[model samples]
Target: MILEFRTYRLKPGTSEDFLRVMAEDSVPLLEKAGLRVVDFGRSLVAEDGHEEAYLIRAFSSLEEHERQEREFYGSEAWLAGPREAIVSRIESYHTIAIETSEEAVEALGRR
Candidate 1:
């Protein structure tokens, strides 16, 4: 299994709106497109600057992750959905994907 962790540095004071869009729209949309959204929420403290948030997902493999994300991004469901609201609030973001055991993933979910 593989895990994809996305960390976002959002525009100041946008955490509430950003997380709302993510929970209410983005997560469901990605799941509909065959992605597993493990968890997502605002961080307790900003990592670098502004407001910080994160999204974690589980994928069968890196190739599957890449393909699914590509299709989801290109799909009209995304372009016409919460894409603007989700993207506009982000100042910057980074992703880290790595192979992991189910136990490891379960541990993350427990948090």
Candidate 2:
């Protein structure tokens, strides 16, 4: 399996709004396209005034991840949803992809 860790450095004071939109709009859309939405949270450690939003999603393989990404991004649903609102509030973003074993996934208490 592969896990993707995504971090969004939100514009100051936008964390709560971003998280609310993600919970209401973003996650359901991604899950509909077959990505496993593992977790979402705020970072405890942050810059003096900047807040970060963290997300974890998993896939069976890189190929699967690519396929789902294409589907999600290409969908009209995504275009019409909270994507614009989500992107506009972000100051920066970063992502890390890691290969892992099923055992490791289970160890994290995730399927």
Candidate 3:
């Protein structure tokens, strides 16, 4: 299995706004595109003098993750939704794909 770990650094004073939009707008759109959003929350550990939020998504493969994300980004739903606003709040974003054991996957509630 593969996990797509995404971290976002928000602009100063924008963390709360970002999280609100993430839950109400982004997560639902991602789910509609078949992305299995496993978890998302503010980071307990600070980094780079920015407020950080992370999202973990389980996927069958990195290829699938890329395909789904590409489609999602191009969709009319995304264009019409909060994409622009959400991105404007982010100072930086990063993503990494990791291979994981079945046990680890299940432990992440990805069954």
Ranking by TM-score: 1, 2, 3
Candidate 1 yields a Cα-based lDDT of: 0.90
Per-residue C-alpha lDDT of model 1 across residues 1-111, encoded as one tens digit per residue: 999999999998899999999988998999888888888898888666679999999998989998988999999999999999999999999999999998888888833
In the range 5-91, model 3's lDDT, one tens digit per residue, is 899988999999899998999888888888888888788977867799988888888789788888989999999998987999999
Q: What is the lDDT of residue 25 in candidate 1?
A: 94
TM-scores, all models, native as reference: 0.93, 0.90, 0.90
For model 1, give the 10-residue run with minimal summed lDDT: 102-111
lDDT of 1 at 77: 98
List per-prediction Cα lDDT, in the order shown: 0.90, 0.86, 0.86
Highest lDDT: give the candidate number. Answer: 1
Residue 90 in candidate 3 has what lDDT?
Answer: 91
Q: Indicate the residue-level lDDT of 17 in model 1.
A: 95
Q: What lDDT, from 0 to 1, does candidate 3 have?
A: 0.86
Give lDDT tens digits, candidate 2, residues 21-85: 88888988888867788888788889766899888888899999899889888888889887898
